[model samples]
Target: MERDKLVYKLKEFQALEAYQVDLFQSQIKSLEDPHIKHAFERFTVREQEHEVFIKDQLYSFNGGTGIVGPAFKFAGMVTGKALDLLSLKDRLKLGIAVEQKAVQMYHEFIEMTRHDPQLKELNKYLSYFMIDEELHQFWFKEHLARIENIEAQPH
Candidate 1:
């Protein structure tokens, strides 16, 4: 029963991630700037991949919808659109914050599954993904700075 609960939680997280990915993709679709659109598209794809990975792991346990996916979709739409207008530095800062939250969630899930062997293994993969996301945030920030420097040139 407890394992079932954990599976449900994982499924809920996956669904939320999926909803956000959809929302991000939609927001990116409206952007005119290629570079910004590309960044958003990349984020959307990465979120979608993470969602699928989580879903596959949780599906074996027959987990059902744990949270309201529609609500997540709506919230993500609003947030993603607002973020799309921010400067690259702000976007990267926001990404870092989001990744930190994800890392915390993964850590909490890891602790919650202390008794579940399979979930513990999944948690290790999730931790690696969280690290990857953190690296992405750093790279975005660095790239933003480089862009700013180039734009500062006299023309």
Candidate 2:
């Protein structure tokens, strides 16, 4: 791809990530468990920070002005509220699936953008994000296991 095209694609990707961060933040409010709510809040903040860094990279590459981070974050808050109705087990299962998708998407983004100098730093960031998503999957699995154990015991 031409450098200009690549830059545009990177900016688009950043905007998409911002949207996702917002979605996750919105989901946080629906969580009944304090621990889960806290975790989601922190995770949302981290994602927002990641979006900002990506926006900065895009700007540095070509003086691009993307969507505001807060706007995307508010969308996330709405999503969280909508998802709040799910049970804990159901929510964790959903979260695990979401993280898996994120990991795959990040990998694909890295592969697709490997040739762009404007995207090199973003690639590294995605690599770290892949690790974080994997960790989230693991945590969700652990929570699932604990829930299973609790359900197994006789009253």
Top candidate when judged by lDDT against the true structure: 2
Please report the candidate that would top TM-score against the real structure: 2
Number of backbone collisions per candidate: 0, 6
Per-residue C-alpha lDDT of model 2 across residues 61-155, encoded as one tens digit per residue: 66665433332122222243556676788777877776676677677877877886766777788788778778877888898889999999998
Question: What's the lDDT for residue 121 in model 2?
Answer: 72
Model 2 quality (TM-score): 0.74
Using Cα atoms with residue i matched to residue i, what is each candidate's TM-score against the true structure? Answer: 0.66, 0.74
Q: Poorest 10 consecutive residues of model 1 by lDDT?
A: 68-77
Q: Itemize residue pairs with steric clashes in candidate 1.
A: none
Candidate 1 local distance difference test against the native: 0.66
